[model samples]
Target: MELSLHIILEKPTAGVAFGLQKGSGNKYETVQIQQTDSGNLDFYLTVTTKGDRLKDALPRFGGPFIQGPYMGNFIYLDIGTLAGQVSPWNRRLKIPMAGITWEIIDQLSADVALMLKTNVAGTAKDGSPNCATVKPFNGWRVVSK
Candidate 1:
C-alpha cells in the first residue's frame, strides 16, 4: 500500500533545517511545497508507508537539526503503540528551534531525541544542553498527505 504522511511546518528559521527519516538506517528526503501568494515559509514531510496494519507499517521517526555544516538528531517519534503518538503530538512544541546555532550544534547527539522535552531542546554544554535546538519554528502538524 502507498500512503503519505503530511507534515506542516509553519514559518521556520530561514537557515535552520529539520527533516524526518522514514525508518532506522534511512536518510532524509524533502518534499517540495509550492509557494503561495501570501509568501509564507512552509515545508512538508510526506512519509510513504506500506502495510496492512498501521501499527506494523509505520516506522519510528528520527529527525535531524541542521545549520550550516553542522547536523544533529532533532526529534524521534516511535510509532505502533496503544497511545499512537510520540510526544507533544498535535500541539505546538515549546522550545525555540532557533537555538540550534552553529556554535553549539556540533556538540549535540542523537540522544537528545530521547529527552522528549516539548519546549526544551536539551541542555547545551557548560551551561550545558541535553538536547539540540531546532530552528525558529512557529509550529508543525503531521497528518496525511
Candidate 2:
C-alpha cells in the first residue's frame, strides 16, 4: 500500500512552535497553521511510503519527524517506506541540500514546493530515494542522518 503523510517542521529560528499539542497525538497543534509570529520558513512535508501495511509502518514515522536540535544546516524529509532501515532511526529518502546556497533561503523554498508536487508523489525501497527531480538539492554529498 502507498501512504501519504503530511508533516510539519518548524524552522529553527521561527518564533513559533509547529508540532503535536497536548493530547494531540501526532496531529499538528491546530488543524490550520497559525501565521508565524516570526517570519521564517517552516517545513510542510508530504511524505509517501512504500510498504505493504500502513499500520505496521506508521509507528516508525514519528521519531525523525519530531522537532529537535538536529544541528544540520538543511531541512530533511523522508519519502520512502518508514519500515526500511539504514540507521537505527531509518533515514532513507532524504532530498539532498548540501552546498545549497543558504544565502537566500527563500529562493530554495521553490525547491521545497516543487518537491511537494513531484518527488513527494512516490518513493523507493531498500533506502533509495524515489522519484528523481531536476538537480533536486545540489548536494555535495548526501548521507541520511
The lDDT per prediction is: 0.27, 0.28
TM for candidate 1 is: 0.25
The deviation in Å at residue 63 for candidate 1 is: 14
- Give the number of the best model, judged by lDDT: 2
The weakest ten consecutive residues by lDDT in model 1 span 76-85
Q: Cα deviation in Å at residue 86, candidate 1?
A: 30
Residue 113 lDDT in candidate 1? 25
lDDT of 1 by residue, 1-145 (tens): 1112233333332222233323333443332412222223333332221222334322222233221211222333221121133323221222232232222222222223221112223212332212233344433322212
Q: After superposition, how far is residue 17 of candidate 1 from its true place, in Å?
A: 3.4
Q: Supply candidate 1's per-residue lDDT for 120.
A: 25
The number of the candidate with the highest TM-score is 1
List ranges where model 2 is wrong by over 4 Å.
1-91, 106-121, 124-145
Every model's TM-score: 0.25, 0.22
- Please give the lDDT score at residue 139 for candidate 2: 41
Scanning candidate 2 in windows of ten residues, the lowest lDDT window is: 15-24
